[model samples]
Target chain A: MTAVEERAGAAGADDYEARLQAFTGVELVPQRRGSDPVNVPMIRHWVEAMGETDPVHTDDDAARATGRSGPVAPASMAQAWVMRGYAASVAPAAGHSPFDDLAELLAEGGYTSVVATDSEFTFARELVPGDEVSVSEVLESISPEKRTGLGVGRFVTTVKTYRDAAGEVVATQRWRLLRFRPPGRGPEPRALRPRPAINRDNAFWFDAAREHRLVIQRCAACGTLRHPPGPVCAACGSLEQDTVEAAGRGAVHSFVVNHHPKHPAFDYPLVVAVVELTEGTRLITNLVGIAPEEVAIGLPVVLDWLDADPELSLPVFRPVAGKGT
Target chain B: MTAALRPAPASVAVGDELPELAIPLTRTLIVATAIASRDYQDVHHDPELAVQRGSKDVFMNILTTNGLVERFVRGWAGSAAVVEAIRIRLGAPNYPGDTMVLRGSVGAVDGRRVEVAVRGENSLGVHVTGTVTVRLPGGAA
Candidate 1:
């Protein structure tokens, strides 16, 4: 038998899969310090790279307009806060970790190369400037050896929990990696589209969608209702606001059929629409369950939930037939 | 925390030009900034991957462009100036081995609110064009 085959056979006989699975639920890395405090300079760099123009992340007045006291770091940046620089990765500190041990074991078994498969993030709150974040990683699961285009390998999944200086949980990430032998390469996978920029102003809106609830923010002072929840009421200029569950009914106010500059995360021709709710607020959302050509302005619609990725759930709109209301 | 450096609303006028600033782009700056922003897109940092994806090389991200625009406006508006709004649209990509020259002119002047028309150009052409509104000192909050 070939050397690789022999190693595979040996691994099987020794029940290496079970051995590796034992690491699940064990702490892999504890309390790794973030390279820097959440600051504006880094945030600026990020927004530039991502092409994000949200004023809440930069303009103080725009942030205050959304009811935030000041600037906020994008929730999608949770992992970036704790990234060890290239120098640290090249010359890591002399500390042994269960992560390193598992990698070594996988390498010994001819699964030396690795690539990130996907990541799932759950955020509890928006991170504001000056918050120092630390992270702890734990093994979540280890899959049995499976034959992939890259060769035989196992998927290693870990959960990273991020905490602020106050020890409040800010975000958690489920990171999965494929450890494989460096032969039999296949077609490259498409990268995920950048996640939505979530913060204190709109986090609750997203959270409510996960539970299949369509909610709109209402000014606690003047009873003005708004979608795309902001910090201040446009009419009353009140900072205090509350939420009201919607009847999930609306109509298409405007729309466009996207056919070019295609992003891998979505299918084209993608139907993007602006829907005006019965409550008089509007939202820019995707139109699903209907053909792009069938969509039109003033078409009555209803709310639907799109579990786009494992970690994200958003509200989409569907056309209503023979609408009277 | 200290005295404001912002020019008084009465002292500012329409068509006034803010001092220009030049930023040098390097691979480290590009990659480090992308990581800092929590952007892990290979096109922003991986030249080989970028080439495979049909880009000449790893290019600057829009977030960095927005941040730079904010920085330029804030630099001229002074420490006490509050940026009220910024609307920007991207054009050609800013790659390494080029310098982005940021220039701006006061578009309009209200009591305390000033609108600055700004553009950042690199060797390829215009990188970003936008307008920023800032509330200067002695202006209505």
Candidate 2:
């Protein structure tokens, strides 16, 4: 048999897995030291990108005004940091990450690894500057699937927890993948590992329970206000920054009308739009109240935040109150 | 986390074929995709998770997978391919350095609306197989 198909085949599964088992275990050995405290620029970038109009994530003084030590980035932003540790730990060896290698070895065990069928994250404390987090990763269990990708031998169910230096569980996430074994000798399917990592507003975006506002981080040096926060000022490359409120007035630079309803995150036939604020920066968002046939480039638009999720407000734009179709 | 995805074709049709496009699955491409979408689950990034999970390497998530499909149709058909509905079945995992063929063929031609069946595949297998509906820019033929 060829080398590619050698493993994952009945005869090959036993033979190849023997060599891989002792080698690719991704279970964390010792706790890892994480990167420095939450970078505001990075958090700012994420908040702005999401078009969240919550006060806490965007306003530092506002945050401090509300009893916070300082401006915190976000709670669920752990996603921005978790994989970096996995990537660093896996860098020297096969160049593949612990997560990536797991799928490969499991496939050798006679299964096909599927990407997250579902995911969700629970947050405890907010991540802020000066807060150092260390991650503890654990492989929870192994399972087998019956009817996917020739039937996969699902091997890994993992929990990656991010704790402050104090051991406080800032965020905890459990992950699952559908691993299918070979059709004839498929592993019996058990309770599917339910993924609990759905997307949600980060802590930074939910700083205050009583306010809503759009945040634009301004580079202290050049007065350059940018959204979807970042480290370097796009124009001057200076990292000095602070959050500022915007007038929410702009012209549509471009837009698209989506008809596909894939992720249950939202309904189908939605409007995705890009607008250029007076500052000359462009931001992406969903345009509400406008139908597919009425969108056009250079159209005037205004900001309207979603009111339901107090912690999170979606920035949706619409034709200027009295503007074009 | 991903900026409400980039602008899409303002309009599309029932069976308009967006010319096939190629997206190199580079390391940067893969990682950027995961980060952009805020997908923290391990299998998408941890190689060991990949090994333990039973596959060759980290696989792309449906979010990124769908984003790619969105990007492909938008880039090819421009403001003409308005994706009304995107139904995709995850086929296989795509690793870094792999070449993804973003191919879309016409599905149906109904009045001013159209749909294009699409996929993003590598030699290992097709990673994303789906269909998209868009309203052509200048209305339908």
Candidate 3:
């Protein structure tokens, strides 16, 4: 697998994809026996936790009625039987699994975090008490890169064949897992700021900001300027509206330095401030290019445009150099 | 226990609702079920390890969630129903002291097969949403 690591490091994305595709249909693990056979105690615990009160799972009479020899394990328990328990999972035995190799191969491409996206089980028969189950997994498919809300990830699907002691296939599972790059981890493309909800009322503001212009909605009837564009002017109760391009100067009327609950799009100790613009309208925007401690009420600032992604542009403020008073 | 199994596919209809099942998310449940399912991930059983791993506390493992989902469907569909498949997407984490109430509706019925759309909600928000496909024996699909 070290060879795989070296190749993955040197290869391009297409080469890596080809290398990963090579593992398709390859068995990921040897036929591994379950640590424990299907038994009543484990079934009891499982049913208890799951709130499964089906009598056939716990009553011999019910099992007889259901035409089983005795109480049978729930069909869903197929995966549980063959799990590599606490010991094996935390500290795997030497002669590691090929699945580990696949994981390492994926992590080389910055896909480290894993989450089960979907699973489908097709059952052949239910396991009665004392039936030993063994499982072997094969790489089924690897999807092309997908952009999810979580991050960029590739879905790896595997098929696990579960068999009883007689080597008869009892069930099989098609399992799909997303190996994603956790947010803010490992060369991830920096996230864009959460998109502001743009509608007829506020689209003009964002559109003006995109052109590096600071515009405020003005009431044509009463000469009142509003920071947030609205359908009707509050001051004069007028529906007539116009915009005025400001000189892009302001003072920090109020501000707060945020240290927790971070978003990947912005740096922190983020300075969010209410800037009182020279046009006499106060709008909330982020303050930039100044240390958090340097931010004070009445601090003179100048407008700047944050081209957040190719689509979004926001008006930000920064303390004016040489006029920090 | 006395829930009657739907003997015919015709007996089940689209838009049928399954009774809601609310499982109390106890700390014992989170730890015990994780161990029972053989998932030793610290985020499922060890609070300190979970905290270090960036989770606020021990959370339910996907396996246990799968089990519970199957149980939810079976408890309604009866023991004789064969669970052909389950496709679930997890959302909010089920932290301890939150109750996940599962509500499901029959989304589709095709002869012997029925698909139920299931949603489980906890205090944080939607914990899990998915669909369960169950096939009944002796149906003329």
Candidate 4:
């Protein structure tokens, strides 16, 4: 048989699409128990890795003061609790999971490349130490072949629900991914800028940027304002914090024109500047709407955004017309 | 000393080189850590799929890289030290059969806070390079 005939007989793209569609509403992971019970040590590790300072995740007294019984896990850590560590995940398992089957089918269809597109989560209750969590995932939807900048792919969405030992639902998450055929010769994969490491502390900042709002983190106790939100107040050491919308106004504090080590994702002679916000904080960002030579310290600038990728939106600074130093 | 114990902030000085930490990268480590971080991209766990995507093998996910960087800095800073911020940029991929060596030095010192300039290097080259700001105990008022 010819290659095309073999491929068609084995499993063509159309057959793969049909098979994938059949998986919608199918349970992928069924009642998978967490490798470890919710505890302070893992919470501590997560908070530290994410630069979170909220005391409730670590300090028992701080949690109690907030009217909780004790320290509670960060709501965003819902998935980490159920992670199958190196040993379990790599070891040969008993049965084939629906996710495995779906993945194999996609690979067979030449949609071997995959990337996570987005995830939405909702928390019903805070998890605490001793809470033995369990999770189950269901394939929600699978899109038809769509051409994207990356390649031709289908969007796969799944819903995972987390429950406590008593089977009480605590959190639910909608996860989406794109399974695509890697481009054979398409413009050397638009070099994707490295993804930002997001955790509980800084997630809200990115979320606000998605809506085109520039918000700054403020300590609820002493009212000191800070950028790049932290779990605790730097000045007052307060755990409680809030956010305030900025005017999106700032000025260039320092800058450097990068001329070498060109990354395909960015233009050459890139103007990278540190903008000093009117609120007295500094943010390192790209300076746009101006020439590299025009970039100068104290140059009055305003906030603009660079939709870096489908999933990333970064706040960039541009010189305010007729308001330069 | 174990990472659980706090190091005296007064004893740590600017320009002090932290003891290097070597972590062997295995296929399991690469894939498992990605799952732990809730990253399901096939390139991080499925080698066959990764090769099809142009990568020789599944690579380490960014979250796992960030987590390992945090672990390395905290291991040096001790349990009492609080990581205020960590900014990292990725370089070479950490494929299986490689050893990632984490090295750092105290970049700056300001009262309770010390900035650590860190880099994780593998056989291919730097896997990650970043700076971590940490607050050590006894120096805080």
Q: What TM-score should be assigned to candidate 3? A: 0.62
Q: Would you estimate the TM-scores of all the predictions?
A: 0.42, 0.36, 0.62, 0.43
Top candidate on lDDT is 3
Q: In order, what is each prediction's RMSD in angstroms?
A: 23.8, 32.7, 12.3, 24.3
Clashes of 4: 2
What is the DockQ for all candidates, taken in turn? 0.07, 0.03, 0.30, 0.06
- Lowest-scoring 10 consecutive residues by lDDT in candidate 4 chain A? A1-10
lDDT of 1 at B19: 88
Worst 10 residues of 2 chain B by lDDT: B1-10
> Where's the lowest-lDDT run of ten residues in candidate 3 chain B?
B1-10
Regions more than 4 Å wrong, model 4:
A1-11, A185-325, B1-141
Compare candidates 1 and 2 on TM-score and give the better one: 1
How well is each residue in A133-181 modelled by candidate 3, as lDDT tens digits?
9999999999988887557899999999999888999988888888887
Candidate 3: clashing pairs of residues:
none
List of clashing residue pairs for candidate 4: A53-A231, A54-A231
Q: A1-325, model 2: which lDDT tens digit per residue? A: 2212322243443455454454433563336655546667666655543333344555666556445666665444565654453354445433444555665676655565345543334556557777777776666665533345535345456676778878787776665456665345554322222232332322333332115565666788999877666767888989777766667888889888777655534546877888887666678887876776888898888876643222234556778864433
- Candidate 3 stretches with Cα past 4 Å from truth are A1-15, A144-152, A189-325, B1-11, B51-54, B110-113, B135-141
Judged by DockQ cut-offs, the docking class of candidate 3 is acceptable
Best of the two (3, 4) by lDDT: 3
Model 2 local distance difference test score: 0.59
What docking grade applies to model 2? incorrect
Model 2, span B1-141: residue lDDT tens: 222222334445545566777767776566656665555556667778766656566766655665566556555544323344445666667787798888897777676456678877897887777665555444433
Q: Between the candidate structures 1 and 4, which one is better when assessed by lDDT?
A: 4
- Model 2 DockQ reads 0.03
Each model's number of backbone clashes? Answer: 14, 73, 0, 2
